[model samples]
Target: MPTISGAGFVVTTLNKILAIAGVAIVLGGVALGFRSVSAGGTVCGSAFQPAAGITPMSCDNALNGAGTLVTIVISAGVLCLIAAAAVKVVRDKVNA
Candidate 1:
């Protein structure tokens, strides 16, 4: 049985954390894109002539909501990346 050293274990754990953060960022991007497209396709206006990609009822609300969601998601993604990097630094210092 090969026993992992302290530095090796710490590095492996850090890599896993970074990988999870990467996945979160990718998923967040995909969600943002999907919501934007879905919101654009919805109707938000009343009897007035809808603009391009605007619907009658759901356009404004959906777009606004999606925008908010995108903001939150992007912020979370950034935080995740920062957290991953910070954790890696912490792990390295502790292992060193």
Candidate 2:
């Protein structure tokens, strides 16, 4: 049987924490974006005006969907990286 290294354990734990934080940040960003869009408000609190004949939508309304999707993708990527790191740490520790 192989023994686990202290460094490996610590690294695995840190990776888990990072994964959780990444997910939280992504969720929060999406929620805020949706709220801003639904409220027809700008995330920056700036008032937007359309051209003389064109009607303008709020920046949030225009950008939130794509922004949320991008955030979610990034979060998923972080989660995958964390998971991979954790697995590598554990495998290394167990095989050492």
TM-score of each: 0.55, 0.43
Whole-model lDDT per candidate: 0.63, 0.55
Error of 1 at 80 (Å): 1.4
Clashes of each: 7, 0
Query: After best superposition, candidate 1 residue 64: deviation in angstroms?
Result: 0.7
Worst 10 residues of 1 by lDDT: 42-51
* Candidate achieving the largest TM-score: 1
| C-alpha-based local distance difference test score of model 1 | 0.63
Q: What is the lDDT, from 0 to 100, of the residue 79 in candidate 1?
A: 76
CA displacement after TM-score superposition, residue 82 of candidate 1 (Å):
1.0
How would you encode candidate 2's per-residue C-alpha lDDT over 1-96 as one tens digit per residue? 755479767766776776677677656555544442223433322122222322345344445454555566667757766775777677667666
User: Could you tell me the TM-score of candidate 2?
Assistant: 0.43
